[model samples]
Target: MSSSLLRRLSVGLAALTGLLGTSLIGIRAADAVTVPILVADVDSGKVIYAQAPTDPWYPASITKLMTTYVALDLVRQGKVSLDSMITISAAAAAEPPSKMGFKPGTQLTLDNALKIIMVKSANDIAYAIGENLGGSIDTFAAMMNETAVRIGMRDSHWYNPNGLPDPRQWTSARDMAVLARALIRDFPDSHDLFSISAIQFGRAVMPNHNGLLGRYPGTDGMKTGFICSGGFNVVATATRNGRRIVTIVMGQPSPRERDVKTADLFDYAFGQSAGWTSPTLEALPASALPAPPDMRPFVCGGKKPPAIEDGPGALSAPGSAAQLIGGSAANSPALALAAFSNPALRARSLPPRAPLQPIAVWIGRNPAEGQQILESQEAEQKAAAANTRAAKLEAAKAKRLAALEAAKQAREARAERAQAAREAAKEAAKTTAKPAPKLAAKAGRPLPHAASAYTAVETPSMPEAKPGKGLSKPAAKATAHKPAPAKAAPAKESTGKSAAKKPAAKKAAAEE
Candidate 1:
């Protein structure tokens, strides 16, 4: 941010003139003079009569003055032609009442649309102009804020293009008065559009809603609006006799009261035309007024809206404020005015949205409030998780039971196969044993003689030994008949004969 812009924003501190002082201004005098009164000289931008000009107030329909000012600037730059046709969109068609009854497909020139906005306080028409010119309401609002800053409107902010009551939407009457002054000064040529007392657009004739224009003489044009939150608000100006003065009355109870008080103010201002001095105005003590309720800031578009640059010669536009919009050759003032008289059908656009900022949250008492909320959420999550786990466990148990049943069936099949295998083995063995004995019988039939001899040999016994001495008596007799040895007698035979003769002689002698 530039130091100058910072200095401008720092001016917000001056806004804290105390809500108590503000409350005192709302009290009416015996003459029914109530609330903040700010009377200003339009040419000099000097405060002639001020009670609480700085005190905050809802700007209401007075915001349209700025809208008109920006539109006229575009017209001056030739970006928007006065007769350019604006095709209303669904979003613009959907704005809450105070409308021109233009359906979604209805079309109007830029000039007529401004007429509707000024006379009818038509939100739909205002949105139509913004959307057509700036692309969207949000984008148009950004341009509005930037324009406000450039024109030195410090105590103001715009959230929407139309001045509908949004809690976040707020502007001070002083800032509004500044806007009205700028409109009159910047586009003297376009000022007649505001003073139009009646407008007839395609069979719809709506009288100008500003009562002051018709009731108060020399009251040429301005705007008036009322919302319950904003009360009765008006940005009124008149060129009377020779002097032009602008009056801003906000938060008044009703339109009749606001108009009547404004008339009284104009009378006072007109009376002071004779040699008014600064010291006399400063001698009046400072009077306070009731501050409007704080509008809680809200962001539209459900999110932070995008920012947009202004078009041409505007701060947000490309190059410098004096430069024409790119691709525009209509540079001469006469050519530009001709283009504005008959603009391209596509030039209407929306205001921009508020600038993005950090979201602010208020904290309450009880130090553990955030923690308690977190804990409660955690408990709920845990319970849900437990239920999920139990469901999974039951599914797993069912799967296990199915597997066990399958295993049992497999075991029975295996037992049946084993028993069949054992029976087959037994039958095979019996068949093989019968074949061996049959082969043996056939072999015996073929070798009958050798078989018989084998049988006789098998019958032969081992020889026994002969009996010894313990044999029978017939064996003993055979052993006694054995022959004896012969005598040796040759020599002895002759000797024996001789001896026998001698023995015979001796025996004869003995017998004698």
Candidate 2:
């Protein structure tokens, strides 16, 4: 690398290292020395000079920069016009200090509210502004966190509508510097609200808290802050010869020390060379801060509002711009009505203990008829349930009857099979019991014992077989033999003749 280029690179690195190390210094005493300071290049948005810039300290009133940013956005969208009236609630009037003493039921336009907020540092007005824009103080704090995320303000959190002494409500000087840059870029036309030195609201004179407006050369406006914990802190911005710079000093003993430290920053920034060596800080360039897309319908007082005249710094309500800018419609819906619930709705007009019925939905002429209708519906539902149970019971009874009948039929078939087997066994036993005759063994004389076995063995009469191709018919007597008279009669009658007739025929044939 060339010698000149290397020299430039080294200088840039040093500048970046110094900027990174800048932090707020914690003061042990209210009158401590070695106060904090930081000077940044506005065009490039880089810190040219810094001392104790990153130190942890309280923000006090300088926290209003973010408040102003949020309010200015509402103005740009026309949801809040400059002359629009804001009614003061009793709660808003109850805030502690740095306030506008508007009586209950008193009204002030948004135009004057911004002035009071900037100059007098009114706490109640800040809360009211937040409540108007964000519905309530708690919800407004959430919006603050969301805004911080969107703007890439990485290290800031908010807890209240006004910057009170919650540990959660702290921010860094560098973070404030980034906010100042955003205020100029985001709300350029409305940005002038920050530079106002004095504003008159009903004979009360309010002067701005920032000390740089008239004292420093080319210094217009920004903001300042103080707290017992933070000591004194200021975020000041100035322009000279078309170059602007923002300086932040936190944790000074007195207000006077904070201003002096900030002036030193300006001197060092103006003296520094134009070119930067650090790629991170050098890359930052001035561009239009993104306008919050608005999707709310333009309307006022129960009528379609007239088309708003577009200003040079025309801001689309969150929805309308998003549609044109390829932004997500799902994020911010089109609000045809008011964005928030009316605070007046929460305001009670009646006393706490009034005779009221919570259960009744609406009052009507015939209350008794309505009650009867409800009773009838209830009765119908009960009847339907009862009918369902009865039907189920009937179905179960039919199923049980079918099972019982099937079991009875099965038992009858088993009994018939058992009786048939028993009859066959009895017939086989009678045939086996008959003694077999033995042939005469003694040539001409039959042995008594052997003859007895062989003597005319009356073979047990076997049941007659049916006349089929393979089986011989049983003896004629076997056919006539009956186990019982009633059992044989049916067979004999079907065979062709009665037993008595057969016997008489046989006797007649013998006489012939």
Q: Please, what is the whole-model Cα lDDT of each candidate in the order they appear?
A: 0.57, 0.55
Over 4 Å off in model 2, which ranges? 1-36, 52-56, 278-512
Model 2 C-alpha lDDT per residue in residues 1-512, reported as the tens digit of each score: 88966665665554343322222121112221222355677666766664434433346677777887777767787777766655667888886566665555555566667666766677777778787778888887887778766775655677766565555566665567778888888877876677776664423455566666666677767877654444456788888778888888764434554564466556556556546563223233322222222222222222342222111112211222111111122222122122112222223122222221111210112335435644665698799999999999999999899999999999998999999999999999988896787423444443355323223322233344567633333444444342222212233343344433556546633533
lDDT of 2 at 465: 55
Tens-place lDDT digits, model 1, residues 20-81: 12223322212122234567778767666665565445565667777777777788889988
Q: Give RMSD to native, each candidate.
A: 30.6, 25.5
